[model samples]
Target: MSSDLVRFDATRLAGMIRAREVSPVEVVRAHLDRIEAVDSRINAIVTVAADALGAARAAEAAVLAGEDVGPLHGVPFTAKDSIDTAGVMTQRGSPIFRGRVPEADATSVARLKAAGAILLAKTNLPEFSYSTETDNLLTGRANNPWDLGRTPGGSSGGESAAIAAGMSPLGLGTDLAISVRGPAANTGIVGLKATHGRVPMTGIWPRVPRRFWHVGPMARSVRDVALAYSLLAGPDGEDGFSTAGLGVDAGVGREPSRPLRVGWLVEPGFGPIDPEVAATVQAAAEALRGVGCLVEPVRIPALERDDALEIFWRLHVMEVKPAFAEVTRGREGEMFAISRAMLAEPDTSVADFVRAEQAAERLRDGFADYFGGHDALLCPVLPIPAHAHGLSEFVINGRAVPATHSLSATVPLNVTGLPGLSIRFGTSRDGLPIGVQIVSGWWAESTVLHLASLLEATSPVRDLRPAI
Candidate 1:
């Protein structure tokens, strides 16, 4: 019964709970049991909520009493450690902030709780949520469920691993360049990095580089992500970026009035993509074309002109370093390697900073131009499948590239504040998950989620699960 319960997505669990076919206690217990059974191997969970079962009992009582409930009523969800939970320890995967617990939930976490979802646990991440791999001094490392030797990707790696392993059905993850989407791609799950500021970042760490950071949902299904996004979006009064008013349409199951137009790309701009990963992107484009959408091969000149990864580094490092320095001020000895590496990066020169700012604008303008003729743009999420833990470089298409090159396909969307979703559509020759990215113009999360749902319905790899 626990096995069956853990297999269901958040939407399925919510429906079953609502119908009284399963009680909230049973659902929560199944997940807690799953975590105990699998988390030691994965190391995805940092701190399990002490009050989770208590909360579940309350939810079950409410359901039995026939009280009104929210859409995610009785469902259990996890959050990356970087996202604050009212009483749960949010260690930020660093020793500098060890034993730290937020007095209040982040807007995202509070919103989920308000929707009647119980806080299941807090997941792991890189120290200060800065690295592309999920390992830190505090929680050690988070291993991918598919192959324990590989990573699930980071800084949202632990959240993706937990969802893929069925330890949690849904969770929240923040993305700067590739945190959410890249990890989801690595783990064969669905992750949404909604338009920047669509969801408030009020309670997440490192608020300095706010423009590039985004908080969104990561789950086992596209519909779950869409549902969470609907509930999480809108203004929170505190986050200046989250000024978008309520009532944004999620468009999960809705089809467009006319055939949607999508363009697919794999190269020249996004650096070197593996043949398998590139084929996955093409397959997704063909699948959309097969579904009667106007799909074609296309390119955005700005990505080719100004390297998005370079631009992101130049702009974000300048903004993020100070915040890191501030938090680690007196505790330099407790810092992790990634944090040290970040601090060691030379400051962005005035001339380079100006150039990067202009290049970012060009990237945004380039996407604007492309979206003028297409509703969505499809591309590879990463150059390769999940690499070995602690790998700092990779060889793609017989060419050597720095580890940061993996962010190539994703950083463009961050630079433009565009909404992007990563969904598993193909499997690598190594038996790893490969995902295709679907992106849309600003404030077009509806379009992104709508198209993702269509793909989800037709995905050949839909039923695949990690052997773990």
Candidate 2:
């Protein structure tokens, strides 16, 4: 029974709770039990909110008392540790902030709670939520439930792992580069990176590169993701960048009038894709075509530039340097080893930042031009499937490249502040999950999600789960 509850997505659980078929306490307990049973091996949860059961009890009483409830009332969810949780530990997978707890929930968390979602726990992340692999000196690593020896993808790795492993039904994760989408693609779930400033980021850490950062939903199903997206999006008037509202429904409506036009690229003008990964993307394009969409191969030449990563790195490093410096000022030894090394590196010059910014502008314009003709771009979220632990670089098609290069396909959306949605499309030969990215123009989340839902209805991996 507990296993079944954990397996049900948030939307199903919400309906059950609302119908009085299940009490919030029962729902929370099922998840808590699942966490206690599975989290030791997964290490996905960093802190189980101490008052989760209390909140669930209150939800039960409210339901019994006939109080009006929100769409997600009594549903359990988790937040990435990098987001403030109001009395729960938000260590950010770094010893630098070890044992630290926030006094206020991040805007998204507060909104979700207000909508009647129970805060179950905080999930793991890379140290300071910095890397693509979720490991740090503070809370160790979050292993892939699909293959314990492999990674679940990082920054939001824990959230993805937890949701994939049925430890959490839904989660909140922040994305600056590929944080959320990478993990979603790696873990066989749905992760939506709404347009820049579409969701408030009032209490998420590493606020530098503020314009590019986004906080969105990561869930087992697109419907649940849409539900959470509606709850969390829009400005709270606190974050300067979050001034724009998410102007459309959470991509839950009908298909477009005419056949949608989608452009796909497996190589995506970046890293070499493993043949299997490439095959899955090709299969996705074919599937879109199978579903009555006009699918074609289109390449944005700007993405092919070798300097793309350099520009992202330069801009990222410049933006985060102050935060890194201030945090590591006297407590350098407490920082993640990678972060320490990164901070010790010499800073980029003004000329380099300026050039990178200009490059970013060109890249953004290039994508804008591409989107002018394409409703969405279909591509691989990563060049390869989830990999083994402690891998510093991935050998794609025999040539070794920096592991962070995995972010190549997804980072362009971040650079342009466009909305990108990742959904499971197919699986690798070894049974690991493989996903395709659907990226749309700025504020086009509804369009992307609508198309993604159409694809989800036909995805072979839609109902699949890791055999953990």
Candidate 3:
């Protein structure tokens, strides 16, 4: 692959378009070609805009007439199915959401359009964005671009796969925990879960998770993620959760000149670590050292030896049950068996809900105090690399792990209401991608990206495309 053709970093694409070195039509054609060539094997995108060429022509015409194009002017992008796009069939990968189309776009989607981005397609997701593996009844399972046998990670799996396969320059992924970050680890890309409420969720279907959900960007480069984020963050009045007008800054371009005071936790706070996962994280730490960052092993005080991981799971089940119920009602739409099973066993009660909320408060407070001095917290995104879908449900090291809550490290960041960024570090011994997750304090997205950009600058994972 020629570097110029395959390189679709948001910043670079924006620059070339701004300089008129490339036409919007050419950019769209390149992406469309990639999708046609690679999406068949991965099944990453459920819908490709039929009008994409015409839209690109309009953008190209604007450029020719010397109209001021927006920052993302004519750049192609994708969003998970759960986010509504006008006139498009948003099959949230469920039979229920099958034909569901919103009259308007989600705020983030609107923002991207306002900034000159062209909406090209809706990526696949788990049923209702509920699971870790991207298998749903409507769109089928999304494969990892790296190894088709393994999963591309969950909920945002399609977005990760699509971006990794070079079908889109940027993607919008809502992280209800591991949905975004996990797939980035699995597919070798950057996925970010923005600070809660930083991006509006108004047009997002069944927004009951209310507290835990976050919408952010995924891309091949930290700068690309950061650029997309700058356009997506801030408030839209419709979402009560919008953190607009807070005088908060997006904080791009702030780089530390010297070694960063970084904290590392090898243990997944409490869960099991596949040996290869641990070594990959440690290797990333060593690489950071080479980049002038002081990496130190540190224990997170927020995580108790008890069931802190359980607390996140219970809370997730609580948030998930109602939303899942709303969509899968009457079995009206084609629902994934996983979603059907989850609905049948909706065991989360009000007591569990209260306890989960309380635990979350405690978790947030603990991290608030802990990050008072550190630049960022780096850890493994998953214990094991991408395994077959149901392996965790069986047994790992003879421990009866909850098949669904395998995303323990990632859920904590969501439950704690902090921003998290996942950067691909290296492949495990089995050749599955390994993700190093960097979590930051509240509204500290800029700091998180600063560290992520450094790692991207120093590591080889920045452009490790799966040779499909």
- The residue-level lDDT of candidate 3 at 421 comes to 91
Q: What is the lDDT of residue 67 in candidate 1?
A: 97
Best model number under lDDT: 1
lDDT per residue (tens digit) for residues 92-186 in model 2:
88887989989999999999999999999999999887888999998998999998999999889999999999989999998878999999989
Q: Which residue runs of candidate 2 sit more than 4 Å off their true CA positions?
A: 248-253
Provide the global lDDT of candidate 2 against the true structure: 0.87
Question: What's the candidate order when arranged by decreasing lDDT?
Answer: 1, 2, 3
Error of 1 at 443 (Å): 0.5
Q: Candidate 2 versus the native: TM-score? A: 0.97
Give TM-scores for every candidate, taking all chains together and pairing residue i with residue i: 0.98, 0.97, 0.93
- The Cα local distance difference test for each model comes to 0.92, 0.87, 0.80
lDDT of 2 at 462: 82
Span of ten consecutive residues with least summed lDDT in model 3 = 244-253
Off by over 4 Å in 1: 246-253
Local accuracy of candidate 1 as per-residue lDDT tens digits, 191-210: 99988889999999886669
Clashes of each: 0, 0, 4
Residue 75, candidate 3: Cα error in Å is 1.0
Of 1 and 2, the candidate ahead on TM-score is: 1
Lowest-lDDT window of 10 residues in candidate 2?
246-255
